[model samples]
Target: MTSKLTTGRAGIRRGAAAIATAGLAAASLVAVVPTPPASAGVGKAGASPQVPQSPPLPQSTQYSADGWKARPEQYDGMDIERDVPITMKDGVKLLADIQRPTRHGKVVPGRFPVLVQQTPYIKTVLSLPPINWALVKRGYVIVTVDVRGTGGSGGKWPVWGEPEHSDGKSVVEWAASHNRPWSDGRVGLFGISYGGINQLFTASQRPKGLKAIAPAVPMGDLYRDLVGKGGRGYLELAPAYLAAVSGLGILPNTNLLKDPATALKNIQEHWDAAAGNLKMIPEMIQGGDRAYDSAWYRERSPLTYVDRIQVPTLLMGGEFDAFQRGTPMLYQRLSAKGTPVQFINGPWSHAIAAIPAAGVSLPGVINEPPGVKLGELQLRWFDHYVRGVPDPALDRRNKQVTYFENGANQWRTARQWPPADVRYQKAYLSGQASKGRPGALGTPVSGTPDTVKWNLFSGLCSRSTFQWLLFGGEFGNGPQKIPCMTDNRYNDQSGLTYDLPVRGRPLRFTGPVNAHFTVSTKSRDSQLTVRLEDVGPDGSAIQLTAGWLSLSMRELERGRSVVRNGMVVQPWHPYTKASQKPMPKNKPVTVDVEIFPASWSVQPGHHLRLAVQTGDFPHLFPPFPQLKDSFGGDVKLWHDKTHPSWITLPTQPS
Candidate 1:
């Protein structure tokens, strides 16, 4: 088998001066070598060069035969390594490539703590080598271990964080005990996405010598973040994640099944089967026993242990990432419980973490934060916490809850999340042709419309259905909108729009979102969809967050539901079996739609837009395919001084 490194649009190249300085500093690190043979010849549109296959090294070897070594040419005077395997207690051997200064035979005066990252993404010889080398030169040991069942490890793959955390904990302990030159008892964990979540899981367990963790773009809840809520799933995220993981699971030298050919075939077969039966993958992968049968899923979930986390943690996520809701929940819980947590978020996707976002480009790769610099941040974090370095950069005062404003490229930080002193404002949705203006009043009422009716047949199509056709079928073929809105053409009022003008200085909303109104359906049961957006000066609407609720399951648990800002706030609650009670048709009832929590700043000129439709395409799977009693034939929203319809927001006071 042959492998090559492609310096695509994403790879970073250092200047001569930087390389020379790195070389001198990394002299005591691991001996440097040329770019790993795996990264050589793999370029944009270029075929990978063939290389001889060598026998697997024995477990007794301190590092894999292809382990971390210096590569002078790859990075001027930098040391590099690749495919170093480490064995864990459960006989699950994992691979990690190390990069550090070549030990100059003299006892290094002080032992440096290790910066560890465990991810499912393959750390190719070229991709992460510079990062490791940079850390080594900076007097730190950098270890990049592939998570269990992904790269050179034994075990069946469970999507997301579960098994990875266990593997990470084991690796941290092993690195501490190993007799390597820089192997001190202290360890710091860092990474993005699955890599990020693992840090949280590992830290929550409060590992013996674990000092600190930096989990960027970290996922918070599994079921809510991954599956769906209010009986709907974020269609695109689940399938895309499964596809990506399937690819990662088939990487060379990672599977115990040995031959990449056979492994790829097996993975493809499983993936194909999964595609055919989407609902069964979770249960099938989990196997027979319900309790702990899916230990991986249970272990990967941070919600299972949020109150237990004690270490100071730095959590980051993207404003639009699938797991955005989870980050705040995790941060709030840990911080309020006095866990010393800091949160940072940006407008980045998962892939951008390892490639630089500005200026430099790797031929075919998306610009992500370069692995080398991310490693440096990890080093600084470790230096301050593990080594007690007293670096001003790692001081608590310098770190806070920072986020990116959609239109603003600059970053903003606040002492606390959901900033304090935000005013809760109300806006009424009335039916009228106002010509794009607010307060175009129709008759306002204190309760829902007396004879509000909607056609049940109209709610058949949804965002999930359209997405299924787009990505799974033909619509995904050509150039499409990058952040496309899910299609909802079949539902009533599909093009419905609502606008609320800003009343004061740029309004910053941070916290749970709510839409409150009295609703009545022509049928016994119905569904309602609500969306929140920020409308730009040019009339372009950017979706901030959304929510949905099935009236049938509107039974709220005691103490979990609160009425605020004219809307009902439903805290996180597990779904319970549906009740057998029946309701009279055409009766008016109060319903609260709770959207996901988000942080967004509505500029002075921009308007807060709320679009109310009976359906949200692709955002969720339609409650029932049969369309039996699902739509409320006619619906009326009442808003006025007495029954003022409004959206509640967590406002931070300036």
Candidate 2:
């Protein structure tokens, strides 16, 4: 915290101030004493958070906990069979790499619980299943498959289309029945990102013998989570990811080596498939305005059919992840239904999701994001749910919710998300910009309206760039990490910034944030971008999380929004074309934008900031059709007695 090196968004993580918080223990939970305020950071007062790292992923690490490392590996080595083809109902062949424990370089004579990960990314690039030695050695069967029309698999990539849904059920049944020699009938699903999401699709089918799933960093709602989060399209990530996967789809799969003639035909099929998906790239932008939240996304998002999935589920999420909104939503829904579930959320972004992995280190390394190893935790989860091994760790009463509080730099356990102790507090927008400073956040007052040009590159150079862009083999630290993730001063300049008056008292908050604004626009529509940040004493500000909303989609689903302690803690929105409404030019419109959740503490010298913009691009932009409605024009922000614009933050007790 004392470094004051806030040049990059990924700058210093350690905090100089200290605050007391509680930590979760293996068998119990207790209060933790204050430590030096080296916190989760980026900005003026922090040194670069990037750190040197190498070696094993967390899934392969051994934990120091009592029963964690106690289970010895049943086998010494592993046997991997690549390009194992399984025929679907339509006669399309999907390729999978199967890994089993080996003894003396030979397959062990035993039936092991099967773990499956279906992905669109090339099968050779391992992440979701990680494909490390530690897992197979511990007496489990690991299966990684390239989804239809991708990798070595035959048929077209469904983009989570119809084929993709049924394909998961087929793959699960295939693993449980076709791989009988190594399978024990009991099966589980595990993977990160693409690999992670397919688990929801497959499990939702109520596939037989699929006992449990561990979907790490998966999106629950494709539309609200990533594609067009808060009614806006992901400008760079959607197309880039589609292109990356489609390009990989055409790679000469290893199947070409096994059968040259047949492989060539399939390779051509891959390109044919890629060509079909590539056409959707431009359509993504058009869909942003016209077809956003269309039937296409509803069919793909797991939220549409989550209730159908009854299996025990484990979710690992990043507070700064692209799917941060969806992760907790999934947890809340499942836990509400009294289903078996566990959610472990940390202070990492999309690419940095594994920062707490077994052998890695970055920020918030106190008790956890890792006290025991992440790999062992999964092992225990599956042991109880899938392998029929009774474990106390599986007890639902124990910390079902484990989260990392960044500024505190410690991982704590809770019975539920937003924990039961949370209370929402409102900070009204007040004052006006003077000199170089923007408006202030303080007690409600009838302040004169402020005007500024709509911001298109609102978060262009901030944490969000890192959160949505980086995918595989990415680290939160080091030179490879994007500088924007560490700082937000660049974007703050383009918007109307409001800072909570520095009260000289520490303030702690976590969970969802709702930014309510009363504004007038010259255009018929506008996009609202709100970022929740923590500003340092030296004027450097770092982004905690952000939210977006196209004005046309401002309508809220009031009955669906949650009210706790008399404040709408979490606002639900129907970002559908049918819900779209026209805004009157030069008239005030009430808009509630849901800020993605985060966990952090405002230290004594630091303050909280809410930066608001009229529009954002490269991060999220309206479709071409809606450009006329949202394209740049000055916006009027009103903070008056009749239209008191404010932000609601879920404050948590220390």
Candidate 3:
């Protein structure tokens, strides 16, 4: 069955918000914090938008870096310093807002360590959060800046380029040297998404006085994470992300907010101004020859310079995030270099991690999940690095890999990723695709070839991206509200599936899933997408994780590839213009697919199933549409001893 489109109120609201008018110059930066929030609520003057009241947050207690319990509301109120200017190496001035702890009007006397966050999403967006309040109460000065461009900050954003690196360094240095009364010269970086990306850029530069960084759900490689994963552009979400960035142009100017009323006025003005068009940014990026890793993508990606990062880093990822593969890769590289680092892979999605429901707060927005612990985690990391506080949980001398297992609903820790104790178990594919029984995965089955047909535009981004965008955060839809795969019956019947025998006991698969297939297609070029599912006795299929490969881009970088149990850990591909070549005519080729990493426990009575198809629509643009590509006919799959096809699961020993 084909996917249906739902353009309801959310879609209409998003459409209205994304359309920006022409020739609106960026707003001017005001040099002082607006007078304290007005005591009385006020309405808008003229047609401007009405000011929004501060969002309400439930009263809650949080743990300090050194493990102390304290409520954010009980802490000393903060002193606000807005639109402060910091000059960069190139003389560009970025605007920043500083919030420091205060007791009865005097800046808390002693010098304190500082926590910095830089974002393209106006700095004012974070001004009212208890998240910042908690940090300031813990005796840390919080400085939030508008990353160059987009927020009264000078200079163009360069879309995540060198400017981010240079500006971040300057900001860290500025926070260290300028806070004579309130800071002792040490600073740590933190933020989510673009904020996370900025931290990576700054840490790579190794700015002096920079203590450490905690980047959540960051983009490790732009091309791999967004534009193209396995050589195909992730069409739907990429454009939406670009549109979100463009919308920032119309957001209320944080530097100009004199009070909540004034801020609301500005917000309405901007929203009203964005009524005609706002697709320019995304169009420009996608309009280029984007089939491969173009220069624009490489320059913005942190994967190129991550090796230079030397500071202690805390990296976090959500199992369902659009960019989930990133943090794990960062963890692996950092650990390989013996750099102090910690990694947490939770069962959240991009929204859940970005706009957390608990412990964190965004102005006028509240979707917090009760009893959240990420704030505590962040506090511990900063305390260990900035304050030199001691805590076994954040100790660099100890193992620090942590993951949340979904089916089991439990957290597990390991010294290294994928937990070195995992052993690879193989399940071979066998069955007649046309005969109607789901293909079976058995122990080294010897059989003839089977064929399956797939149309590229069938599924909807695997339901992860849409879930995050429409919902406030990843968990916005709540448990049982949004599922990764819906029912899976139609999809499994439409494609090729190899079902494993029912399990007699529980099985925990804690790492990457690898698949090897020997096949040939009549089509000039074909893309292979592999999905892993947990099938219950009732035949319900739950998607675990998936991997993709572009047949033409399958030339592996032999020296860079690592092989274990005959499956490449990460099949390294050149994906360069010179390395692109069509598959041999009707000749069988062996291709390895490295599925995204996952942590899941399969219970007794459940069986594992593998599904292979040529495309997952509205997620990644199909290769056929761009190049007018199509398979010659039914794609042939070989499974005899001469050309055995199997999948290797990283299972933890029982």
Candidate 4:
């Protein structure tokens, strides 16, 4: 009945050149490997009495443009070395590369408690050497560094995580006062994405001896991890991850590339001048007005330091993560401020949680089968929080919450985190015709339903004719039936479906998902989205979490709403502003739509779906085809029984 959609300067320059050639070929394959030294070890711990597993594969060895080195007969008991600098205290030296274990005969170090990471990708080649040789052959000392401006560090890069939280608290106070030889001043931090957002901005600056931190898919909130959800900017991950970290800050390394075909033509002309200066990121965040301005893009956000985090945190994420709502909003703001948090999620993406899960390998690194070992659960969480190891199985109050359900890949723990007993159900949307025909199916209601109609189209075409055939192109199609929710052939009754049906046992849902309903439009302001499916058994619906609003920024912020089991938690609503008046086309108004946190179970005859459309092609970036004031006319959809559409399940705990 009314519509508009934009975005197509040749599909935003071919999605910004396929995200800048897959982020400069993954940061030039993590900068040609070689960093390594600082104490490279492996033999000695118990001198060889035992512990010698990992090594059924991973030994391909092949690094030449001048690095990859390490061949002292391939170590035999393992102990390699390379460059290891660490000057800091404001003089800025950085560059680290340690790996431990050797202490002669039985490698028994005096003090041992360090696990830092600090990355700009390329700590001697996309590190993670079989989880740093299984945490230095099970002794732990690790290191890594190279932040402040990327490898061979110095300064000037500062791309994300609030200037790497004071350079990751000055590389954990210079790895706890260079006490070297595995000396302890206590430290722990791991990495994954931007070294897990510099371990949550150096554990939110609680630095000192640091204590513990894991970070995994962490990015926590640089405007919802690189501008997205609503503040929109994720045009395929910000100009291809800022032209692959500004083409790894102007290529070079291999000890400063001396020739090799003129250093691969000056690293492809500094990756085409950092992908042509990614259209001056909104004028460099409006001339860095400060707040750490890159154009005041919300002052390089981190959700403004979620209450300045306290330590003992873990926070991992993935629901095909692209920073899945900043890792559950840093585990719901560090477990609502009590700290000592945990929270994990799976069914990963974002480089499949740093490789390995297909068969699972670690004998040196390349058997590549295991996808989520997360470096052996971040070395048993930095060996029970930086080596005070009593190992009560990593007790951060036991089960803080964990998830994974790509058709049950297993691993599901929960003492809290969208698991209370789940039972919030609502499915309503009778049919009868109003704007574009076909309705009269009536009677099969449970909650909200009284109106539903849709039909919008304009510029940039394909506003999802079933997500352009279930996620466009290639052969990566697996979870189907989610294009227009059945009845095939792009059925569009302004699409609205809600199912529940189950029977007994097996029905666990997890956090964040909202929808409210009651809309009306013909054009003035429009955009609803809301997905949340599951379906299966033969009908195939999949797609578990999705949300987007824009009906003149919907409103709903006050105490942020809450209802639990019957669904409705609406908190996290940073729409910011936009609604001075624009909803006349037909006018109805109700808007809620949150949808993003997830953790499923379903089972027992399975069904739990919910879909409401307005458009979401290419994973968003459509609305704005001159509707001028955010279009929204003649587009009604309401749930019945006096508007009672619901869905809020985090239940689990017998």
Top-lDDT structure, candidate number: 2
- Lowest-lDDT window of 10 residues in candidate 4? 69-78
lDDT of 4 by residue, 340-398 (tens): 77776766554444432111132432221133344355655665677654555456345
The superposed Cα distance between candidate 3 and the true structure at residue 353, in angstroms, equals 2.4
- Candidate 3 least-lDDT 10 residues: 21-30
| Order of candidate numbers by TM-score, starting with the best | 2, 3, 1, 4
How many steric clashes does model 4 contain? 46
TM-score of 4: 0.35
TM-score top scorer = 2
Candidate 1 local lDDT, 376-462, one digit each (tens): 344445556776654453465433676665533445667666655545655556544222333322234343332223333332344
**Candidate 3 local accuracy as lDDT?**
0.64
* TM-score, model 1 to reference: 0.70
Model 1 lDDT, residue 533, Cα: 72
The C-alpha stretches of model 3 lying farther than 4 A from their native spots are 1-74, 105-110, 178-180, 250-252, 255-288, 355-358, 361-372, 434-436, 464-486, 623-627, 631-634
What's the lDDT of the predicted structure labeled candidate 4?
Answer: 0.51
Per-residue lDDT of candidate 3, residues 1-654 (tens digit): 111122233543443211210000010100011111111111112231233221232233445433444334323556667766666677665667777766655555556778888776676655443435566666677787776655656665566778777777767766665323455667888777777777888888887778988887787788777667777667666666555654784555755554455345444544443332244334433433455766767778887778899889888777877667767887888888888988877776665565431135333332222333565557667777887765564574344787887677777779898788888788788765553476788687788888867567545534433432423232235433545444554566657888776566677788777688898877666777788887887887877788877777777875776567656766666665566677776789888777888888877888777888777666666444333445443467889889989887888865
Candidate 2 overall Cα lDDT vs. reference?
0.69
